[model samples]
Target chain A: MKLRTAFFLNTNKMKFITLIVIITFNTILHSQSQTGLVQYGHKQSMGMGAPIGIDYNANLIFDNENSLYTFAKDSLEGGHIRESVYIEKDKDNFFVNSKITNKLGFQYYVDKENKKLLSRDIGFNYVKEEIPTINWEISDEKKDIGSFECLKASTEFRGRTYTAWFTTSIPLPYGPWKLQGLPGLILEAYDTNKEIYFYFKSIKYPMDSKIKIQKPNSESENKEWITFSEYKKTLINKHKKAIENGRMLIEGFDSADTAEDKYTMGNSYIEIFDNE
Target chain B: MKKILFILLCSFVSFGFTNERIEPISENESAEITLPVKVETYNFPYENGTITLTIFDNGICEQGTVTGTLSTHCDDDGIADYVWSGTICREHIDALIMQFNASC
Candidate 1:
């Protein structure tokens, strides 16, 4: 009876120690933050005659398995109006809204452990997508961007084929926007059509700052997330309703003209959709 | 009379469409603080041709102008290392302009 009681006590103590060990390991793995900055030059357009070239700075922050990528301009510029238009009474004025490079204000969070991505859309709604696997075929070709020697890699993502140059010197396995899955940090990437380009200007490692990446609640009573395909369908339906209700009408133009103008002069998503 | 009106209308349209660059100038203004924040005006020849009244922290611009014309159309597309905006509150910009004008 004494031996049995001692054995039982030892079993209970072992279970308690196991639980504590698991909890401590989880805390250590999840509580650390690594933040870095990347400067990028972009050339994008509304599928018009020529694309507009622009520049941007982005912040890449990550923990052990999750990473948050956001535009540094939107995070720092605070509240600044982009553009506004005032109509003249009975005057035929042609005005185009400023072409936005990253209109979605997308905060892309990658969960490597789950093989998924959480993106904050334009309407402040979140969308979770399976990370697109762009079976990258790396080539032995190499070049130097700034001080780091970079290797060339190519992959087809969504509807566009992209060529990317990454450096193993950083070994961050991250890049601006949605381009990732490389073994190293991507310094430059451009699609075949050159409609979009991301050239690296500078990089900061082990940044002297702490960035908190808070994931939006998806299970709350009011918060929700929709799949990318479902969101596209909803967007099309919303546009159809807006057209039917004449809410998207120009003062002296028909719905067809407005739609054409929207497609021609207005901006499009970086990932071109077949629905368009 | 119709010809005159047409020419006048043409001139008015030209004035409305032409790009204009306006810069505010000041010389005698001085502040007592170690670092002074003053208002400076700049007009850029970029996409939208924006005119901005900037609140410049002189502490950062000891080497003359840091980003005068660069931050015209928002800081994201500019050449400046820092991001700033020309869309600051008009009242706040006006107050800075007034203070700079009055300081000595």
Candidate 2:
């Protein structure tokens, strides 16, 4: 036989090249064990606050204890854009406060070295825009959430269509407010009209050891970055005259006589930019 | 021997189809919850009084003790007083009173 049929055709071409290198290393170890792990959950309820108030322009306040305030008028009026209320107390600790306005010729910049709180109009020095740079796209399907195991990713920056879900199993990649760079940690995100969702409510990992990380001063830093539709078209063209004078100050406003004269006030503003 | 017993039964059926096993809790399952308890009344424009409290558990506010005049305009003229007790856990007090009645 011609050398045993050329040694059985070279062992069937080395067993078809070892079954294509073990099926391409088992499809890259099954997509790296399905993207490792790091999925969390959270979606509490109780919100009625944030209803019109952005000190400087945009107004419409109705009060009876059903609060609704907003403020950040025109290109988010000189830095330190105000409108605070974070209150997280179980998966860590939190506290934020700032909703007092009406002092005129403003000039407040309390950047506890970037904790943020800037205001200016007393002598004007405005001109600081930049905030737009987010990109992601990791899909191939996989879901579980609530014991971890997620994937579905997306990104269309500035004009909306976020939709994130990351994981890698509890590897801490933070989320809830300023979304983070994924690889593992975005628990959940929304946009396509869920209005704005962000879920992933708990994670402690802090046994008797201080771990602080807060820094953002110098007008709460931001030399560049934009898109969220260029900060919502720079907040509707710099608060289109404070949203037309806060819809003419709530035209004939009378939220139940300011909720029975419990003294209610309102304001609104939204101007953010850094890039589109 | 029959081709080495068919290559050890095809390597134990390809290692039992690549080790498939996932449990995710299930010991004859059992879990239920329902919570809700409310009695609102808050108006403390910095302390001149009126806070009939009662929002227990999760963001707890129990019969919080405090009464009258603490002025800063009594919390900007909204009146200032307090009184709330506690006992929530009916599925987190009906999900915080359906997220404070927004019927979440």
User: Estimated TM-score per prediction?
Assistant: 0.53, 0.26
User: Candidate 1, residue A188: CA error in Å?
Assistant: 1.9
Ten-residue region with minimum lDDT total, candidate 1 chain A: A249-258
Candidate 2 RMSD to the real structure: 28.6
Q: Write the per-residue lDDT of candidate 2 for residues A156-220, one digit (tens) a residue.
A: 65444668887766443434334444666666776554334455544333223322222222343
When only the first chain is scored, the TM-scores of the models are: 0.67, 0.31
Count of backbone clashes, every candidate in sequence = 0, 58
Cα lDDT, all candidates: 0.50, 0.33
* Local lDDT at A216 for model 2: 20
All models, RMSD in angstroms? 16.2, 28.6
The fnat scores of all predictions, in order, read 0.00, 0.00
Writing each residue's lDDT as its tens digit, candidate 2 over B26-94 gives: 567753322332222222221342212122212432322211100011011111111111222222322
Displacement of the residue A223 alpha carbon in candidate 1, Å: 3.0
| lDDT of candidate 1 over A1-276, digit per residue (tens) | 999999999999999999999999887544442455666665553232233333345556664466666652454334333431211111221222222233324477888888888877544557788987778999999999989899999998866778999988767677767788898888898886565677777776556665566654556427678998876665455434323222111111111111222331112345655564
Best by DockQ: 1
